[model samples]
Target: MNPSITGFDYQRVTVAEDVALNVAVGGSGSPIVLLHGFPQTHLMWRHVAADLAADHTVICPDLRGYGASDKPAGTVPDAYAKRTMAADIVALARELGHDRFALAGHDRGALVAIRAGLDHPGAVTHLASLDVLPTLDMWDVLHGVTAAVGFHLFLMAQPPGLPEELIGAAPDAFFGHFLDIWTRDPEAIPAEVRAAYLRACREAVPSIVADYRASAGVDVAHDRADRAAGNQLRMPVTVLQQDWGAALGFDAAGIWRAWAPDLEHRTVSCGHFMAEEAPAETVKALRDLLAR
Candidate 1:
């Protein structure tokens, strides 16, 4: 099938020996980096990137373990930690001639953006995270039957061998479950896009598992250290989510307030794939963040 973003240039930039990200670059103005979530790639930014290109230089990259990026060996634990992934993003922006940029990420990418904001506050002028609580808050909020909604988190959090092996056996079904359930608009994700996601995920099963493994262990530890240090995101921050707080009986804004001092947290009536399902709203929210 034809590509998602027409006329966009693609490059594989090396971040580390075993890591290089496939990046799509378009437009020509203040740089804005859009990171995709799990089981997907830079293609997720198709609608938003094209629109943003009218006013901003849009950089959409497949993160370290997904899409066309390097899926390094999973033997070493914590290799896929968000801290490490965030560093890759920083290096990516530097390679693209942008030392600092506005950043937005969804799902797994949101976690990476969160870490990036905390670890390299100077590099991110404005930060936006869609559909996630901070790592510690995520674990804290999740309990009882509500936690069942995040069965995948617990499954992937297990030790290296089992998670990877079980997922590898039926990678498509395992990953496709999220794509099917999380989005409200079943038609928002085209058949071609769905196939592409499954294909990328199936091929990168080991690295994908390693990525989630880091979240349960190293990513959480990194978040804790940041909390202990009382370091908050220095840049302007905006969060758009599906109001999991209302459903789970916790104040989403309250939890985010602890991390983002300069905050604009709001709930959007959209699916997890807001960028694809509601691009205009997503872009409007992001434009507001950029203006901030």
Candidate 2:
């Protein structure tokens, strides 16, 4: 059986036609939806969700084309676009009877949450992103040797068949590479959870690639349009990220401030998988965001 968030009730909430998200929801009070990043499932939020559940109604869901969620064919660019994924999240919350709620995400999920905050500002009461730049700025800052770190982004962004075939050929190596490197503390993700992440990624290669591919193309276009329109995340926004600025040669918080006016940008000392490696700090930051 698949590992799930402990103390949370699991269900399939229909977010869109032919796309129902696998969600684990718990606790009660004001609602907050937590989204997981790449190469993992809602289970990535297991630790943070449990703590947040003590007071807030925490909802954790596998984004479309991820985990146990419905994987509609990514036959078109828009299929896996962050916009569509964000819509799925908004609908998921509505189905669970929440019209407005605090939203947070890590990595890929952070991309979705950013899109949601831009597209559905009225519905996303508070917004927080963990360890990722917005799509447009992400592409803008990556240059020269610094871009080497994002090799997977370029590989997966290829037209279609080739990237899928290449990754599918060695799914474990491709996905496990991130799982191993991005994490600081191996024990943070016990063997079972690591196994679960690998299993899910191995099974969802095409959709996962599609998700990244969209980020390279349509997602960038959407972010560009939003920036051009002077659209920004109006809600209280908190960003928790490693101090990639010093190494990557860009002010991470400065870039985030361009998109979020009311922003609290923080740099974490932990690894990329901050939620897992430092759940206490993650929870504290989230609680602070909610309080604002």
Candidate 3:
């Protein structure tokens, strides 16, 4: 039930001793790694990856704990930290013979891309982030009543047992909720692809929760350290968001500016799932960022 992204060859590459990533690679020329977000697989980038593959070598991988990737159920909160996830991406690209490449991430993947750009400046030529704020800013923005929009964040942030138990109780309903609400058009994601996402998520519950759990714990600590050290993305960065700041009363661009000195922050008129909801615009934004 993979997305209808033809012409790409899939492979399982070991990025770490205990972890391997399921990757989809296509096309030629300079490489660009595309990372998918929550409740979805690399299939989420079918369209954008396909388009980018026409010119660049598009490397799309299911971030470590999601999709068909290796999901080690470690109790440590740092298990799924962006730093670890970001290292996974870098290792995957290097395994595929890409020492340096342009990187774009959507949702949770965007968080990873931000970390990659910051942590591996010389290795990432360009960086693009869609529909997400940095980890520290994300937690800060979710303070008080505005946090209601991301109840899943709070739920997943809790200690292991309950969240996993509750989500696993009705895996389809839990994952489908985000898929249904996050997209602007219900029909944007084909029913079969939706089914695939649900199936994968259902099978990867523990790994998935661990991924979110790391955000509240280790991810925040890493962000705070980076912030204190004044470590911003050294590459040209482009951030495309749904203008949540307007509704939530936080300055999205201003927040991102603190983490990325050379940044182009713009708002997209789409839902949280920008790549699927607005592929053309998403592709254009990535192209602009790559050219930088």
Off by over 4 Å in 2: none
lDDT by residue (62-81, candidate 1, tens digit) is 99889888878867765788
lDDT of each: 0.90, 0.94, 0.90
Q: For model 2, how does the per-residue alpha-carbon lDDT over 224-243 read when each residue is reduced to its tens digit?
A: 89989999999999999997
- Model 3: number of backbone collisions: 0
Best by TM-score: 2
Across 139-240, the per-residue lDDT of candidate 3 in tens digits comes to 888878888999999999888799999999999999999998888898888989999999999999998999888989898998999999988898999999
Candidate achieving higher TM-score, 2 or 3: 2
Candidate 1 — which residues are off by over 4 angstroms? none
- For each candidate in turn, the TM-score is 0.98, 0.99, 0.98
Q: After TM-score superposition, what is the CA distance of residue 143 in candidate 2 from its true location, in Å?
A: 0.6
Top-lDDT candidate index: 2
**Model 3 reaches what TM-score against the true structure?**
0.98
Model 2: colliding residue pairs: none
lDDT of 1 at 251: 95
